[model samples]
Target: MNIKEKYELSSRYETAKKDYEKWGIDVDKALDILKDIKISIHCWQGDDVTGFEANNQELSGGIAATGNYPGKARNAEELRKDLDKALSLIPGKHKVNLHAIYAETDGKFVDRDELKPEHFANWVKWAKENGLGLDFNPTIFSHEKAADNLTLSSPNKEIRDFWIRHAIASRKIGEYFGKELGQTCLTNLWIPDGYKDIPADRLGPRKRLKDSLEEIFSVEIDKKYNLDAVESKVFGIGAESYTVGSSEFYINFVNKNNLVPLLDTGHYHPTEVVSDKLSAMTLFNDKVALHVSRPVRWDSDHVVIFDDELKEIAKEIVRNDSLDKIIIGLDYFDASINRIAAWTIGSRNMIKALLSALLIPNDYLRKLQDDGNFTERLALMEEFKTYPLGDIWNYYCAKNNVPVGEEWIKEVKKYEEEVLNNRK
Candidate 1:
């Protein structure tokens, strides 16, 4: 930015700081804490959920990336390049979440169960250079074994065992990332084992899923190296009637097993919201993980926006003082737009939400709640909506050396012209 723009940003930031200080909020402290908080950016978005698995089959198991956006990443290097571009546009150093399919096997056909740390050696090296940590998930869907829309919960022992092994390997890979990067990697399992129609035997699949998880968790890794989390879904496209890994099942399982529970914002009933679940989860579990997503009428994994629920979710993390107790990650794959722009928008919105949350006078608001001052509470809550959040946000972006306001658009356009438009 030019000197005039820099002077204006500084002046506005000062005025914004005064606005927040009226509520006894520390703008500098909030930005400091925000810098330390890392959101795991999912790698699948760059490639539209396509991975490097050789001779990959159609993306099955009830999930689909709807758009055929031009210049999608075709290989691991290109995906990494896309991710690098996205990260540069976004402020703060963050982690990258990967699926087993993202393993770089160099054109060799390596099954999920056989994946090892060596396959991700290049990723680890790149992450080290970029100062990013890595998170992983086992690819339990979009495979021949999962053609019937069942995996860990399959009645067939062979198919179930295959997924169980894959899950086991995924945890190990996550551990490797943690050990190598000095940050605990979360290995989350979101099994896509469910039925399209009403099941004759719901308990049968639950029993099998429980058994598979038990076996996978039996070979434990150090928590300092890796932590485990289980994500449950209400339903995917084909699994509308019954989701074997339902919310109740995974909650009970994770609670019993002492593993972290991951709440996907998109994986709940139409009336349900994950923002409402965070307080209880953080209160009960040592750490609760979150897949921050935007569901358009379903688990569509649309790009996240600065919506009410997004702000509420951030409030739960900040107001509850559970920022350190919650693991946050962005999980959405939208092929309808420029993928880098999608990543930048969603990630910046997340950070913006957190910053907005930090600027709230949460302690006083809670006191108002406890004192039963409903009218004033409601009044102040609505009043704060017009607070100078954008000023501080622009300052934060500028401070982090990122493009402030619409300036990032120029960078994205430049990359599209120089790199993406040529990816034929």
Candidate 2:
């Protein structure tokens, strides 16, 4: 599939007025700004697969561990009700990923005895009714029980065995989703499968990782469908810090199996300089799909806070005509921040970043390319540094009469203030 088919852009906007007031932007203007660009917005946040409190379906495995809806939702019906609320809020083309709950606890898997096929059907039906496509992650099958803490070097051989098995299982799950969903869905697999320590644990597990990709890539398909595997990294915990090396490693791995690799912007923040992040993307440009979000020291997938430096890297990606290769989604969530806001802000910011990058004059960009300082010059580009991609995005929501309340403004203002003060 082409970049438009693969990325099919999207974001979350809580309300029109808030979007407009914040940036005085609108949908048509946003559309004109992004002319010929393919964009899709959210139907709603999916549940967290890990069972962590308040599951946001941005990624799928975490909610399954808890075996209950983090939203305290009682059944598939209630889940539908909540999702319906989200759908109504947006009222158009939809893009969504499945939650970990559906994989592990929603009564659909053979390994999890509690799953009922009817419940699963109802969930899919609800999504289809609203015109939203499923972003599937199959590892929900592994949540049948809690995972024993496993690292490559953990004392227990069982933990090592579990990781290997889980990797294989995740691929199978993706294949299953492809079959079950038929042409009605799209899948993005962000594997949480990575070593928590150095390579010595089995040293051979990297081989297992390759085997996992092979399984997913080998799937048979008859129609256009998007399959993306996100290379995600966790920060803060040293023991959990092993996965991801050079961009070369990512390209080599995906190229070996003929699978696409997703670049989560935050994953590179704590290590791998920003310029390398772009180079990593360039190496896999044909197979790249950018995952956008802010970085906190060691903490990741933070709220959609735009960084000029990060935008510079992204701008070059866009100006070089790779923007079409990106499907921007929010990699953020918070107990304190309204979940919907996280989606809207992160998505809006990503669109803004792309436009800001595109607004730069071609003459200047060519100079950077010639100077061998393209990345740095892109970073210093004035338009990308100041353009408001969200002005029209914010305005369109208000024109449609979507509510953008004062409190929401207060929260966003606070966020801006905090971000600015930190730079000082």
Work out the TM-score per prediction. Answer: 0.99, 0.64
* Residue-by-residue lDDT tens digits, candidate 1, 1-424: 9999999999999998998998899899999999999999999999888888897878888788999888889998999999999999898999999999999898999998999999999999999999999999998888999977888888789998898889999999999999999999999998777888988999988998899999999997999999999999999888989999999998899999999999999999879999999988877899999999999999999999999999999999999989899999999999999999999999999999999999999999999999999999999999999999999999999999999998999999999999999999
- Which digits, one per residue and each the tens of the lDDT, describe model 2 over residues 215-312? 44565543244454545444223325454222445567767665566666666547554435555565655545555555666444466656765576
Query: Which numbered prediction scores highest in lDDT against the true structure?
Result: 1
Query: Which residue segments of model 2 deviate by more than 4 Å?
Result: 1-30, 33-92, 103-109, 112-120, 140-186, 190-202, 215-223, 226-238, 244-249, 269-276, 283-285, 362-364, 367-380, 383-391, 398-424
**Global local distance difference test of model 1:** 0.93
Among these predictions, the greatest TM-score belongs to 1
> Model 1 misses residue 146 by how many Å?
0.5
Q: In terms of TM-score, how similar is model 1 to the real structure?
A: 0.99
Error of 2 at 368 (Å): 6.8
